[model samples]
Target: MVQYTPRWVGKQEESIHIAHIASVKIDTNLLLSNVLIETTGGANPIRCHGHHKADAVRMKALIERYQNDYYRGGGAPVGSAESTPAGR
Candidate 1:
């Protein structure tokens, strides 16, 4: 599971389990790099910014690895496809 604390005023932290995460997207530009974590729990993806591009990439990889491990361990919902991709 990944625990993320959003940089928002008066906002509480949130926890995202590996089995529930749908995707991890990394967006980078000349100035900043951000990671968007999409989950099956909601419509809004978790946005994490202010990290180096390499760090964001590493985070994405780690999340995908956990997700893959979850599915391989038979944690995916019944009747769902077993060979689903790690990220969308």
Candidate 2:
């Protein structure tokens, strides 16, 4: 989740599961960056603003890696598979 404290009334937070994420976009200036994370549920996109360019790039990379792993592994639990179908 990305959180921002706005004037102390309450904090605002945004989160999306890797499988629910529709897209991740990044916009960069000379030094700063912004990220937009869109979800398949059609809710408000998560807006991440004013980060370093390198950090934004890293965030995008991590998200992509997670998404890839989730899809490639069929959302399996960590180390749950053991016996082969033909054997068991």
Candidate 3:
């Protein structure tokens, strides 16, 4: 899970599950780095900022790994063949 706290008032905190994430993008300027997380639900993408460029890169890599694993069935699904009594 990823939790984001807004930089200003009147904005509620947001939490996103890795499984629900569709993509991770990074944008960097001279002083700040932003990580944009797009979700399958089509809501506003979660924007995480104030990170270093290297940190943003790492975050993108991690999210991509999770997304890849999620799509490729790297983790066993509930009642999947790997979880069946005979297949176990």
Which candidate comes out best when scored by TM-score? 2
Q: Which ten residues in a row have the lowest lDDT in candidate 1?
A: 79-88
* Whole-model Cα lDDT of every candidate shown, in order: 0.75, 0.75, 0.77
Error of 2 at 86 (Å): 24
Stretches of candidate 2 above 4 Å error?
A: 1-7, 76-88
Model 1, span 11-67: residue lDDT tens: 566776677788889999797799998989778988887889989999988777666
Once superposed on the true structure, which residue ranges of model 3 sit more than 4 Å away at CA?
A: 6-13, 74-88
- TM-score per candidate: 0.69, 0.73, 0.67
Candidate order, TM-score descending: 2, 1, 3
lDDT of 2: 0.75
Per-residue lDDT for 1-88 in model 3, tens only?
Answer: 5574656665566777768888888899998899888999999988887899999999888777666665677664444577467777
* Least well predicted 10-residue stretch by lDDT in candidate 2: 76-85
TM-score of 1: 0.69
Stronger candidate by TM-score (2 vs 3): 2
Query: Ten residues in a row with the worst lDDT in model 3?
Result: 74-83
